[model samples]
Target: MPSVRRLRPVWAETPGTVPPPPGAPAPAAVAVQPGLDELGTPLADVTFVVVDLETTGGRAGTDAITEIGAVKVRGGEVLGEFQTLVDPGGPVPPFIQVLTGITTSMLVGAPRIEEVLPSFLEFARGAVLVAHNAPFDVGFLRAAAARCERAWPGFQVVDTVRLARRVVLRDEAPNHKLSTLAALFRAEVAPNHRALSDARATVDVLHALLGRLAPLGVTHLEDLADAADPVPSDVRRRSTLADGLPDAPGVYLFRGPREEVLYVGTSTTSLRKRVRSYFTSAEKRGRMTEMVRLAVRVDPVVCATPLEARVRELRLIAEHAPRYNRRSRAPERMPWVRLTDEAYPRLSVVRDVRSGTAHIGPFASQASAQLAVEALHETFAVRRCTRRLPLLPAAGAHACVLAELGRCGAPCTGGQDHADYGTVADQVRAAMAGDPGEVVAAHAARIRTLVAQERFEEAATVRDRLLAFARGAARTQRHAPLARCAELVAARRTDDGGWELVLVRHGRLAGTVRVDRRTDPRPVVATLRATGEHVAAPTAPATAAHPEETDLVLAWLEQPGVRLVEISGEWASPVRSAQSVRDAVAAVAVDLLLPRPPLLDDVPPARPGAGAPSAPAGPDVPAQGARRTA
Candidate 1:
């Protein structure tokens, strides 16, 4: 090291310097007035206060402030400086002392943060705050101000880190750190891990960044915040592609040179903003950046509301299988768990849902469908042996292990009567139709037993299977009423004081139309009916609806202000719907998974005189997977 220079407070004897006495009132000049210029105000006219802080650690709450340094400048001229040593009321850790050269001894007799904060606030008044990494310094200041019962001045903040990332080329500087940038720009003062030196160094870096921004048309203070975002020249040149986009809810498609859709996306607020964002450096995904480079044109489809936009996006992705879009491209390939119609009904996973069959799922995957099936089998005495049993079993057909273990009724061997088997089959159908309380309760009881036995892994496995069954049952039951309905109209108010109307047919969204405020809605309704695509009623067992689109529609329907505008058929979730059973299962499952004390507390105590709650009776259906026992 050359020679260590003892540092003095930079604010001492500087122009407009005023050091108030300890515990004195805050200065009158400390009050910051809002800026006169709007967002488009020129950068050169805006005053900036470059600030830095040396602290004991990174956390604002736990860390003690050692020093604060700031430089106020306007039009590239220094207006004043603020620098002070703060008695943090705690000892500085040795590690911090080594890193910052600010020992605990140096803080002795220094003014507490409360004594120095008011003067610094006065010096930085009426100025935009700039810092290398703003959040750190700004966070500490705000925390200290709060502790001192002083209102934060609420200065507009700018971070040099963000600006440097936008403007400085990687080859020009190895990194955006203050020391590196100070040397790169040959600043007058070199940063030495001290607050004042580092802050002065930052002021020069700020000026250098401003110089680089001027050529990029970043004259306005507001534009400077995003000046560092690197928009490729080719993308910038193609900005006209978004000119025709509407400032309304819609989906947009980016097309490659060969007219192939490169990406599909939706925006609820503004198609223009969302589409335009792809051309700017704000889109940091590497794959997206490449996609933009390849894109030659933009396409927009306006929708009545965000729900329609989302639905359209899903449909478009499914139709095109766009290379850039990630989700809902294989909706047709999703699997469903169907209960085959037979004298001996069996659960099977099928790709296509046929008309008129009891089924549950448009499960995310084949494995998830299997899990749901497993959950149903584990709880109900549904036949698990995969034998195709005739109306009357063959005389010599042998019983399987599932039947031997009493997990299934030995229907294959004629050990059970047909009438008894039919009853079990009916019970299974009822469970799938939404009366899942018995299955859920059984699983809950199993989970509790497993936990008591300390078989936690087994308990977790049972819990997962139960959750899968509950979720699948809930989805099936909730959509069943809508699926049965021939047609319905629902309306929700839009943010712009307009009405968004949705046409639903057999649980599928037929069409959506928006009516503007002060506009007659009769014509819009007529137009919607004339142009809307008709969604045919799904054949029984209905295939699982597209979950994303279905969720969007369901959420809109459930919104507080949503109203049923019209209905051509009945649509209602039954009072004893599977959704309620799913909720009950979830609550019980959660209670079982918690630590022992709560788990024990939540379990109902077995009474000497009371029996377990009897399963509620519903339409008698055959027990799924269960055969008549010998």
Candidate 2:
């Protein structure tokens, strides 16, 4: 008690007040100080713990982890390392032993996963998680935590494999596997299927990926997290090419280094946004990626409306034949099913439509044209013989087997009366002119008969033929009116509180303009009229304006709220037309025969003028119409 009299005050001996012993070095300063919020933290200030686990098998839910290894890093400097062998509480499989090179004997005295996981969790606390194919390692840790009744802290995770796929090109590495990526980046340590070795390799890979992200403006943690979405360096360099583009509806052309158009595309809004998107991480198509990398400049054609943009895009694609454009570039080469201009007409699939010929299609392919022809022949007694038939039958002209089976009128051999054959020809012409009611009904009856007999395969063939013809017939009916019109004006409301106006002249896109809600549209309408383009009218004997263009115009006109502002010529679909009947029957057949929901009507009857616009019959059809005396 006498010796303690001289003791120093308690405050003097406090840890904060205490001084370091002599000759001891002061504690080194921490290079990085993380922010209060991880999302707001700078990439250089945050700590990352790249982890890897060797598990008993592929599935985390069913498999137990055997080893844990992690490296804690800040500012690309390793602060600490953790490694432990875990006893899975069961014998490790032979395949796992061979894969990870960890034997059962090595885990004999090791701590159980329940014990080892706690230490790893503490080591990785308050740090971002990183791994190659992160799902495999993080998933196992989460499953283990759940089984151990431990609260698993949610951590921001980064997958190096995903990062590598975005950062490295396919030609640079055959795949994004750990070993391949480690070798490609020349990591400080090679992955050997062991936890620590793989973890060390992944750390190097993480640093490499971070270095790559710095050039992409990834200075913040959130930006670093999004580094896996890659924008190629070349594409990124050319992003400024879109800076001059207007944020309006338009078509854009990406020009290559040689100034050749590389790609043609259209957007209904913000040409700048659409063009720049091709150079960003969001563009993932491999072909488009290559195209963007090769693109040196972007050219935009601003339009007053989206319809005009679409039409311009189609026209540009057809003209340039851009290597990157796959659709609408070859509409001129599409085939058509034509009824020949002869005494006795025969069905033929021809690429070049002659003037004054009754044709049924601008079919997608020769096969589709042939299918339409076959469906037509199955229903009508049209002459199938290729021979030229005189007004009166020639004596020695041999009749083909089609005549013997009553599939054709055999006008070439005089096997049928002239007036009778002419009647069949009229029926064929009516069907070709978008009146497919009789043909569709006959095929539908045949399909029902085949189903009644339990011959499903044969019925399916007939059903497919009917569907094909129905599709072509519908297209013809929808587009033929627009093609035949002299001039028309239509308008539809846009999503952004504007009006889209389309002008058609001679069945082709004449002009398109947009009217703002706050502005009077009279001036714009006058401007459109002044600058309206002139195009060839849809006429018989020649393939009409590209069906694709006509279809586009038709679709816009058919929109629910579209208004017909003006029309010089009549724009109509036939009343009680065969196309309407075909659509009704085909709709029901598709529901019943195809793998779809139950039919709306169990037995749909062919209803004339039921499901189509009403237009007068085409000019080529006889005044008598598609109706025939039985």
Candidate 3:
């Protein structure tokens, strides 16, 4: 990890450069200093902590941030600056380093997120934030806040990107990328894309853009703040589609004029960014651009897991027959390898899942799916020539050329018995399921067994299959979650060999309650029962013969007359758990509840919770999958 040194304010330094001890009082507050105009007249000037971050990747929640840079500027004068590389806690993609020039070696000694976030928050206190793409910077900052258990800095934002688009580029700028705007204004940028250098450049860009917009009645900060960035009405409409969106893996739909669907797509990244990109891409204007002018709204459906998102997206496209979506009949007819229902198992390609056979894939492309089926057949040797089974003998009564080639233990030729054939079938099924961890384990075991018996060639083939399985699974599973709502269940072993239950609603740290494994017959039982409704108990972990057991409490709570209860805490998510079901019952709750913003509006005759939240969405990991039915 790159080391992070805390940024000190030049105007008002803390008593000591080091942080005050946890229980110590925070340093005294600093008053804002006034600035002078060119004529020596006092001006109501304000300072800004202009910040920028270069991250390992774009997905804020999943990707580790690699570097941070910020400078405090007052009246266009630099007061103080800070910069540091961050240890991503994961591998840094080569392209990221190429772009940012922050190599892995640069971060080897840096502080982790847990330490840097608080210091940065304090440095940014009492200053309005200025950035090129404000949301991109803010999104990562907000995520850091959530991780550190702090609220986002309550400062206002000034976006040079938005300002240029709304005020200066009224003639339709060719491209609004930072580099483009910088060139247009003749602003010189540093050679490396280091964070602090970039932040300073952005501050300069803000000043230049402000000069252009000042003549357009954008002199005051408040005027620029309130001016709706003159984005295409279509862009604005599509942007709203991200409102109330769960931070899970899912697909979204864009609708044009007269409710005609314009686009259908999936994103393992931010749904907000994915949908927003269509309007902001370089191909911003053209035939598509004209259609955007007539665009009315954006629609979305959140999925739980990446697997679930892929499945749900395909299902929804087929069902809705949306106007913009391309015909995806290929996925439906994609062949899957399945075992025939016979005394001796026969492998064959079935084009559809609804063929009344147990099958694995409706692969997006048929070619890849066929290759997978062929590879499995070669490894397992399951009667590829196919001349009606049971014509010659029982399940394990014969041998084929594959067994002689050391590729298969021929069950069809009786070299392998029925029971052993069943074992091989199970292995084939596991590989088909596309889970690498399990496949690796099974293949490793097979290789070890073969190698110990001096079957080197067979071991090599098993090793090859393992590698193939790993690669295939990676491509298929690299998607976001599908379910929109889920109960995040975590089980960690306690020091005394017990288990702990820590439940978080949304991203807030709601509560931590432990369960003792010895006396508790079932730990899941205890937690589920305590959900939504309160069941009184001693502060310590449960003991044998306790007055209230988890099962009994849950059973009684489920009764018709039992009312629903709500747990309280610093929850910031829109979805509420245990409330709709346990209302009127004693609620197990936290008291430090923050007020919630409104949820996004749904399309088509309007469903509930559609208005945009009065406050913006909290920066947290999006929940995945389709919304669960209440």
Candidate 4:
């Protein structure tokens, strides 16, 4: 048995320390035992064959692996290294060629996957595999294994991606892309996007992240694999979604055996990757424990835009009224906080769901929204209990004691004047209008008025407020584009094994498949299902995306044999198509909004005390709910 030991640093083992053997091993040679400590726990006695693959596209199921890089390490030392570019029986795309600088001319005489697969298997045997987003690379390898009619050389996988997210990152970073991590770690760059280069980068990033997190008890391969946030209740022993998902924006419904929705979600990106995330993320694991256990099949409705996704999600929740979706119902039923038009202004609670109504919340919990409303009232003095104001004290009625507490202006008892309080109430009303442009304009006008009156000190304060409002408006607008651009495409194996979908956007594709007695089926099937179904329906705005829409996609599809043909040339009759597209898109967007619940539709009510115990129309409900929900 190999002795477990600590790994020496990479710098300590310079290049040229080991020479290539006279001949490569035979196809069926015994496989190397992989080192489980590639993530840098104490060096284990086991050996590791660090591996990397350069592929034609991002989707493992659809993309072919063109290059492979593998290195054997044991006792903290490099034992051997293997690298090659396999000639997939297809033309390489130009952009992929550019990204990897692996031209068709260069691979003219390379070995096929059949020839390379066995060597890789031999090199990787017995070793725990390590890679950045190991699942992605491994998915490709598994696909290759299927092609060759062999089991994926049985081994555990350690993902640098998972490690980075769980223990490496300090806070919620914007992204966790391998390139981004590579840059941060200052990994060697022989040729980025190439199999060997990326493998080296993966190793470097793994080292850095492990060095930072080893103290957190991540000492072994199993420890890291189990380190997932939303740990899957069902381990994918056989059926992986690699070939089962369509790479598009769409709503996905997780169902129990009897067709009950365990959860509803959307992915504008890769469905397989997104689904894998739920099973792999550490934090998301806690939130999805129950759903994963109950999930038997996943259903999806594809969309053209993210806005459409959200619309569909809400519609589905309302239509199906799934037991999993409880969060969204409260907000739908609760009353909204409205600012009254009456003089001396009072806040009222309205239950009707209509536009043009300035409201705060329809929170799930009335008490929470009410508390928020109270807190806001304390800060801004918005009205709480609405009534006919400025009335003479009723017979035997003293005064609402809250007036003295500064909660109410005491208009009922004539304790305070109206004009003085009216100005403050007006500002609060303007703020509650919930129109970004209106709020910004209102604040800007206030600033200008203060300046004209020579109240420089006050003018400065108002100016700051205006700036803050403008910043907020800008942020909202920024998110608007993202929300609009976001869309999903959902495809899953049907009862009889067929697939269906609605729309897709941004050229991303995703889908899922069942595991059964089949030959290497991922590559051909995933792409075939995606092509036959809906192509991404880019909205008008998507045509003008930054970096030039067509060019970017074309660049991505530039490898040999990859071609992009204009499918629909700005449809002559686009009004209906656009609407259809938008609706489809919104369905997916709504799906994205479907709360990522352990169950589903977990958005609580926005109004406090709106559900029970009190008159539903109490003005306190909306204000309270909004604050609590917010």
Pick the TM-score winner.
1
Residues 1-630, candidate 1, lDDT per residue (tens digit)? 222222222211222357789999887866646465433666666788999999999999888799998887766777777888999999999999999999999989999998999989988889999999998999999999999999998988999998888877899988999999999988889999899899989988888878777766666777776564467677677777788799999999999999999989999989999888877767878788788888888899998778888888988988888898878678667778888877787888888777666888677778878988998888767777655778888877888888878888887888787788778878777888746877777888898899889898888787777666656666665566567666656666668877777877776788888787777655665677567777767764352346556656666666566666555655444345455554465576567663321221111222222111112211221111111110
Model 2 clash pairs? 354-541, 355-541, 356-541, 572-615, 573-614, 573-615, 574-615
TM for candidate 3 is 0.33
User: Which ranges in model 2 have alpha carbons more than 4 Å from their true place?
Assistant: 1-46, 49-227, 354-357, 449-457, 494-498, 540-544, 576-593, 596-630
Candidate 2 differs from the real structure by a C-alpha RMSD in angstroms, to one decimal, of 15.0
Candidate 1 TM-score to native: 0.65
- Please provide, for model 3 over 1-630, each residue's C-alpha lDDT reduced to its tens digit, 9 standing for 90 to 100: 333323222322221257678999998978857444222211125667889888988887878788889988765566778777778787788998788777888889888888888888788888888887888888888888787798875778887777777655545458777767766766656424778878867766766766665555444555556453444545555555556766656787767666776656677646766666666644454655655565677677675333334444665676666655665623335455566665556666665333333344334455545554555665564556465656345654556676788766665666666777667666565555433334444545665677678786766555444433333332221110101112233234445655444332221122334446464524443454356223232211111111112112222222232222222311121122111111101111111121121211110111123111122211211221212221
* Candidate ranking (TM-score, best to worst): 1, 2, 4, 3
Candidate lDDT scores, in order, read 0.74, 0.74, 0.52, 0.52
**Per-prediction TM-score to the true structure, in the order listed:** 0.65, 0.63, 0.33, 0.40
Count of backbone clashes, every candidate in sequence: 22, 7, 46, 99
Count backbone overlaps in model 2.
7
Give the alpha carbon lDDT tens digit for every residue of 1-630 in model 2.
Answer: 111112122211322235679999986766867555434566767788999999889999998888998888777667888899999878899999999899889889999988888889889999999998998999999999999999999998988888787678899889988898889889879999999899989988777776676665566677766566467567788889889899998999999988899999999889999988887877879999888778888899988777778888888988999999988678768888888988778889887767676776677878878888999889888877676778987778788888788787677776787788778878877877756778877987887788778787887787767766665665565566566567777666678777777878755788887777776655666677778887766564232455666666766665566655556655556554544554555565665564332221211222244222223322211111112110
lDDT of 3 at 483: 11
> Which portions of model 1 show Cα errors greater than 4 Å?
1-50, 53-68, 71-130, 135-244, 541-547, 594-630
